[model samples]
Target: MGASGSARPAPFLRIAQLLRDRVTSGMWSVGDQLPSRAALSAEFGVGDNVVRRAQEALIEEGLLEGRAGSGTFVRAPRERRVLRRTVSGTTSPAPAGFTGTWEARSIAKVPAGPETAFRLGIGDDGMCVLTTYEFFTDSRPVLLATSWEPMAVTGGSAVVLPEGGPLAGAGVITRMRHLGIAITRVVEVPRPIRLNRDQAHLLGLATGAQATFIERTHYADGRAVETADWVVPSELWDITYTIAAPPPGT
Candidate 1:
């Protein structure tokens, strides 16, 4: 169904809907390669903008993924990430197999700057401990993470953990959980960020590299517990999501 009596909805929405139907009906299965933009535009009778909009919407929904030189394709299904909101602030454990070896750079109790204050909802007087780690996957640097925790919660514990430890094993969320804080939800936001010199060295890229900036906030008992910023190179990884329709007839 579409707006009003129009069988052909808005071009991009129609494309999205049609693609969704095909995926739901199993016409396009996981890992199936999609036609090129030109082919899709010809088939849908739309311009590149419409097709681009359609592709971007599906990408945001985690259905289809686009590669630089490679065409769009159905992403392999992954575990459903149910967004849970709870009082005991906790974060989902790090994705398994993301750890190979890590280099611990520095851990210090630092002042919470403007960005940190806004993300953690801390006051000007509040201080946060910053922990920086260079995480490698398959013996290559994948992400450079800097975690910020309120001094009241993790001030002492922050400097205790060793550098380059297993992300899941030495993850802060797990540590917070043990301290009686249960993370009920995690908020993940990704954006394009300019990489600095230090970030470049950690990720094996040159200075001024473009990277995906990931910011995550962990919550427990309706309050933010921890926040982290991850700098990941554009060429190193792909993000996938699965979108599905309601099961058969309600």
Candidate 2:
């Protein structure tokens, strides 16, 4: 407590900030073991529990790592890749400096479930194509995505199969363009979620870890033709969007 009787910052937070400063200022090098909890507690005039809380916070932030049977150690900085979306309804690939590869498997003529139908604005009985994708960076899994498109939009066309034919691997906008469907706008909504068991296994993350859930829909002439959901591990990627302003005169 201070002389003025005002509330002080939580002990754990102050300790965490002190430790973070040491890390950022090069006082602690990568792979260096942090002082024991007892030492830190005595040095900071706090309880051991407070020291533990501070260390745990750093672990979650990827600044410190705990090794089983070994002491806590500083961790190497994480590489953050950006997923960039443009207002032209086009998505750019990861920046050149980022090294990652994506694998996708697609199924066609699948019946759209009720939720999928609702998002596509189609009948519940309509059939659609579905594709699942997993992305890896530096041999570490980081992203998972599932996409759906109504068959009524691309059935009997050269782009029927999202991963087959001449337009294979081409994005939805380009494939739809080849079929004369001009997508003018896309809507995206993002929320935080916990990684489920299967998603955790696929992305190599701990179950219940923090992640981002994004729902996206593509429109051509104000009609929904495609929809998708992306599961991205927050620790592995950063997302950015670019919106172009409307022209003058309304």
Candidate 3:
């Protein structure tokens, strides 16, 4: 809330979003000249000053640029690459044609955060094995993952530490299977969010950049054996989901 205390943004902010939508929707393209502010003002039924403020906002977001005499043009187009997602389970490497590598740190006996505890069906004070991952393709970071597995499920077992022991680098599916736990289903929910300072730093992006947040949980015996938060930069990657089909009719 600002001085006005109205929850709604100003006219300029709304106008700016409309302009950005055109570029992102491919109705406008890189290097394409935008309609003059006066023209847009007439179309939007707003004052030219409001239009200018809107354009300035888009420029700050790197979506457009203003020329001294040539007027405004679309500077950057929202181009995103595809990242394949399979239902089989992820905690692994990137797909073929791309080399994916990640650095992970596992901390044991850590208290679970509220969200983590809820996802794992445990109390807030429950102990969990938290593993944070920084996944990259080549030298460019693409994805971030933070997994929390209830120690009640893996503690005192060979798979206590997700990144250690004989099962080092082995994903949740394999590790849980070795412990005789059959993961029958996986559920993922996606959310749109802005990058925090730390996440933006690792992804080489500016703070408040757009990203996709995925809450993925693996279920075994109707219990959430492992739950993870995966972050993907919207500026770079588009998530593609691949669903496997059954072989024959029952």
Candidate that would win on TM-score? 2
lDDT of 1 by residue, 1-250 (tens): 6467737567799898888888889999998988888898999888988887787667556677655446778865433222222323222233443435666554555777888888888875577766677765555556687777788776555323424333333566677766777777777788998677577545545455567787878888678877888776665566543334699989
For model 2, give the 10-residue run with minimal summed lDDT. 89-98
Candidate maximizing lDDT: 3
| Residue clash pairs of candidate 2 | none
Candidate 1, RMSD to the unseen true structure: 12.5
| Model 3 bad stretches (over 4 Å) | 1-80, 89-98, 246-250
Model 1 CA lDDT for position 84: 25
Candidate 3 residue lDDT tens string, 1-250: 5476558889999999999899889999898999888899999999999998788667547687665557788875444578776645444423323356878899999999788888989999999998998887655576898999999999999889887888888788888988999889988899999888688667655567789998889899789999988898887787888888788984
Alpha-carbon lDDT, every model: 0.66, 0.80, 0.81
lDDT of 2 by residue, 115-189 (tens): 999999998889999988887776656788898989999889888877788878777888888988888888989
What's each prediction's clash count?
11, 0, 0
- lDDT of candidate 1 vs native? 0.66
Cα TM-score per model:
0.54, 0.67, 0.66
